[model samples]
Target: MNLESPKVTLDKSTEETFNFLSDVKNFESLMPENISKFEVLEEDKFLFALKGMPEIILKKKEAIPNNKIVLGAAGGKLDFSLVADITEVATDKSEVQLTFNGEFNAMMAMMIKGPISKFIETLATNMKTTV
Candidate 1:
């Protein structure tokens, strides 16, 4: 399944936003307030558990300087890629778009689409204000 987050205009520059996202630990700030657990396993990897979901580990796959950051699951029940795209709007402003691409069977996708889509949207929305 593929989900695209709502575009967000950030007060920081593209480079600044990209730099922040390049560090996997920074994502803890973007998670829901009710998250049950968050652990940084390494500089480029971390695990976070939501209230009802199993802990998921995310690892930094690539950083495209001032352009994008690619992250993916580090072996678990769920496999997915979370990409952050940064576009410069001005010297000190930027627009960010987040996309989630998950590898799921048709049955699983049909069952989790609603909540997963909402989760992706929430992540995008939070990034707007959090950054």
Candidate 2:
């Protein structure tokens, strides 16, 4: 299944925004307040957990400077990828949108659609203040 989050404008330039997301450590600030656990394992990988959810390990899969960053699950019951697309809108202003792609059975997908939807939305919203 696939889900796309609403585009959010950031005050920084695309390059700046991209740089911020390039480091795994920076993601800690972008996570929701409800995040139960978080740790940066390396420059390109991190582990995070939300309340009532199993811990997930994610690693950077692909990156296009000042354009995109794709993170894939490194270890989890589910296989998924999250892509961040960045676009320059004005001088020092940029837009970022997130897309989540997951491979899951119909039952699992149905069960997670709502929670995952909220999770990505929260991430996108956090970008506004945390970036």
Candidate 3:
């Protein structure tokens, strides 16, 4: 599996950050608003209805409050897992780190990284505002 981990610091309390990030709906809102249709399978899962390489629906198979969340995707040309953890640095600051570990060929890995990075950046931006 190829691994890519990125961290983003936000000016928000741990509780406040968790309060927003812990909710699946908030995460969906952070996604590209242009996605034509979106389906949320549960409190921590959603499907992205768009056309793209290795395009596959994603589901939040696991989540731990204020700590970690995991998402699974399988279909199209990809099968992968996205996991993220949140850590508190102070009363009004926190750091969110995400690790992408999955079994995908190098070519596919390179293709998916750009969009996924942007998506995560968007998540950080949105969380910054919400928290």
Candidate 4:
């Protein structure tokens, strides 16, 4: 399954946003308010648990300076990647987009599509203001 989140315009520069996102711990601020647990396991990895889902580990797999950050599941039940694409709009402004690509069977996709999409959308929107 593939999911694209709405793009958000941030008041910070692309480099600023990229620097903030490069730290996996910063993602805790983007998670839903109901998140049950969050832990930073390493410089590039973190574990979080949503209300209903099992704990998930995410690791920063790749990063392109001032451009994009790619995070993937790390030793978890889910198989997915979350990508953040950043583009400079001005010296002090940038646009950021979040996307989710997951490996799931049809039944699983059908079951989680709505909630997962909403989650990604919320994350993207919140990221704008957070930055």
Q: Top lDDT: which candidate number? A: 2
Per-residue lDDT of model 1, residues 5-115, tens digit only: 889898999988988888778888888776899999999999998888778888999889999989899998888998988999999999998888998999999987886
What do the candidate models score in CA lDDT, each in turn?
A: 0.87, 0.93, 0.67, 0.92
Task: Rank all candidate structures by their lDDT, best first, as comma-separated numbers.
Answer: 2, 4, 1, 3
Better of 1 and 4 by TM-score: 4
Q: Tens digits of per-residue lDDT for model 4 on 21-121?
A: 99989999999887999999999999998898888899999999999999999995678999999999999999999999998999999998998898889
How do all the candidates rank in terms of TM-score, highest first? 2, 4, 1, 3
TM-score for each prediction?
0.93, 0.97, 0.74, 0.96
Q: Per-residue lDDT of 9-82 in model 2, one digit per residue for the tens?
A: 99999999999988889888888888999998988999999989889999999999999999999986789999
Candidate 3 lDDT tens digits, 1-131: 54544577888766677677666666667666555666666655666654453335767777777777777774555677777678988878888876666777889768777777766566566655565
Clash number by candidate, in order: 0, 0, 0, 0
In model 1, what is the error at residue 76, expressed in angstroms? Answer: 1.0
Please state the error at residue 101 of candidate 3 in Å.
1.9
Runs of candidate 2 with Cα error greater than 4 angstroms are none
10 residues in a row with least lDDT, candidate 2: 24-33
Which structure is stronger by lDDT: 3 or 4? Answer: 4
